[model samples]
Target: MAKFPIDFLWGGATSASQYEGGHNEGGRGLSHMDFIRRIEKSDKDKVFPINVTKKMFDDHKTHENEYNFPFRRGSDFYHRYKEDIALLAEMGFKTFRLSISWSRLFPTGLEKTPCEEGVQFYHNVFQECRKYDIEPLVTMIHYDIPVYLTESMNGWEDPKMIELFVHYTKFLIDEYKDEVKYWITFNEINMIMNSSYLGGGMFVECSDKPAETCIHQALHHQLIASALTVKYFHENSKDGLVGNMIARLQNYPYTCSSKDVLATQQQNQFNYFPTDIQVKGYYPASILNYYRKNNIDIDWYPNYEEILKEGTVDFASISYYHTAVISSEPDKQEPIGAFIRNLENPYNEITSWGWGIDPTGLRITLNDMTDRYGVPIFIVENGLAAHDQITKDLKIHDEYRIEYIKAHLRAIKEAIGDGCDVMGYTSWGCIDLVSCGDAQMTKRYGYVYVDADDKGNGTYKRYPKDSFYWYRNVIKDNGADI
Candidate 1:
């Protein structure tokens, strides 16, 4: 087996909203994620509802049900960081990719001073990682925006959010400059186009402006905020590497027809436009054409061009879960709740959640990203979400998870061999936590299992699964043992 680089960071990725359970502790205020409740739906209905309306928000806010909100209490990582970091250290994690809760620090987006207790909580978490000699890759803002921002100004739709987000980023960089060296400005930034409610906290039904107008305007504000944050981090922090995170959903032509190929190209362009602007520090001509064709006008400031140029990211980071197929045919059966319409691929196996398993897609994405932008690429999020069964003996076999990871790792190694400047791979949800898709706990994606269920009934005890030992060995051998 080909050995990985000695300094390759082998670790896992997690977000604060999905893992941390102390929603009300340490002076934490409600976030947009806190306002979102997991709705009951049939298996036919997608795991998460993509189209959120103002009516749904209104009903959910006043609803009498208590358990509708699943993320209110995540896997309890807030109180279990010590135990979790110990497990990560045992697995030989060289780095741990996690996000800082923006709401935790500035309870409300307009706060001039941060919550001291909330600041101390993250300080303690970073201290724990230091004790284990694990490098922390902290994301400045995940999907958890301050609920007050959305309620008051309709999230990023208002240009004022750019200033507020920059303030929050400055505070974090100033306080944690010594502890965190790797920073990501946003999580899946392009999702703002498709999942505006969850990604940008913009409620379309509540906005007086057109939905498309609001979405694009919010996206512009976020882009500005991201660039400003990157520029500030490099200027203030010592030796900090700031990057942009995007959902690297690779698209394949469903058929050999030219139309299918064109469709795939267009879809891929939409996915890459955000990263292109962030990395290249300017809008691509294709994106400008797209805006004109759609009649979407962004509110650009006088210094916006210079801001982007100065704020270009040092590297590019992506979250790769599954690949999608695109076809030009109008009658294609579209996947439910997918950001892009996808045709079923006959060559790949489907997961329980209707995602296609394509390890080679990982290599394709890595190569494509490297070829487009000559910067180090990081696989910040990649893992399988399956129905893991724990036997009566209190052990989870999970050979399937090991197999999934091994195939992906082999694909990554091939990408490295193909001259892709890959940085490291961080498997998503290294420890069991709340699922972002369905907000369910049963969708397990961790090597270490947590005793929790969808209804939040469990001791929250952490246990090492069979894949845990296998991963430890793989790390011990530096990715050669697998």
Candidate 2:
């Protein structure tokens, strides 16, 4: 039997806003996500309604814009974290990847004093994870920012927010330097690729300005913030590997033709350019040229050069999901990438959330990050989001999810065989909780299922899914004999 290293980490991933239900508890205040709750004025707004058709994002359409559609009460993980952590431990998780809600820590963006109650919540959470010998890998900022920061302070558009983020991060390090050993500076730093607003809370507050300038400024601020974080951690001896977590949604060419290959290259470059600049400490020629072509002038801060030189990430973490297909035309040149679209999956297996299932994309992403960055990588987030049903026997026979994870694991093994220095695998959504992108509870990705409904009603009962036993055995066997 082939064997994985004994030290290889096996775990699950989650975020504070998705699971933590006590939105108003402790000293936590309403987050940028809280505003998502206000979109329920129409019946179409009752459920999470994100459609990628031509009309949804069109301003002329009378339909509700998917971006502004309200996200509902996510599975209240804030209140049920202990029970959830116990389930993760029972599943033999070695590390738990989760985020601390920044707004929860500083309700009004920047404050004179730390929120003791909010700080203590994480202390208890980490202590619980420690009880099971599970190392906690924390991400400093997930998608949610304090709406106060977004509306009042311009959401990372101001470099002062970079200073505020540094203060918050330093406070967290000082607070948890002993308990936590792995940190991701941002949840998905490159999430700015799709929609900067949705990915990192960067562009939403800048609706009044030219979007091109606003996006450029937001990217500049995020880069500076990430670099400062790395510098602080390195100088302070924070006792952890601080890296940037990126969304590695792979892109494939539509065909073997030269145009298709160019399209694929363009897409990859566009997706990875931001992190390449931050992690590599220099701008990619491709990105600089792209910005120049768009007439986007980034008033590159003077201190940023030193910050970049001093604060490269210790490593890189990537999350893999379904890949997209791109085709190139002579006249169709995208400023950022090729014209992108999803390919129809011949394999009829779709995730519960309608995402195509393609396990091979995971291996492609791991190898790409390793080859490009030349750093050890963490599989920070990957899983199947499914509409699960609990039987009368109180069991969720989710063999489909088990197969999805196993196929991806096998693909990851292939990447390892090809000599990628992969460090760990933390499947996203360790407990049945809210979907961060759309804010629905039905799409679950946990080895342990929680009894919660879309309307936020349930006993919050924890039931071990069929994948639970499979994952436990996989860990117990040390990635062999699966």
> Best by TM-score, which number?
1
lDDT of 1 by residue, 1-482 (tens): 45577888899999999899899998999888876776555433443435456677777777736536778888899999999999999999989999999999999889999999989998998999999999999988888898899889889898999999999999999999999989999999888777778888878767777777788788888999999998888899878899999988888888899988888888788889889999999989987888798788777866999999999999999998888888777787343224544466789887777777899999999999999999999999999888888888899999988999999998998898888888899999999988887677888999999998888888999989999999999888888754
Give the per-residue Cα lDDT of candidate 2 at 382.
91
Residue lDDT tens for model 2, 117-209: 999889999999999999999999877777677656657666677878888888888888899999998887765545555544554434455
Each candidate structure's TM-score, on Cα atoms with residue i matched to residue i, is 0.97, 0.90
User: What would the C-alpha RMSD of candidate 2 be, to one decimal place?
Assistant: 4.5
Q: What is the lDDT of residue 75 in candidate 1?
A: 88
- Give the CA lDDT, 0 to 100, for residue 406 in model 2: 90
lDDT of candidate 1 at residue 382, scale 0 to 100: 93
| Each model's lDDT | 0.86, 0.74
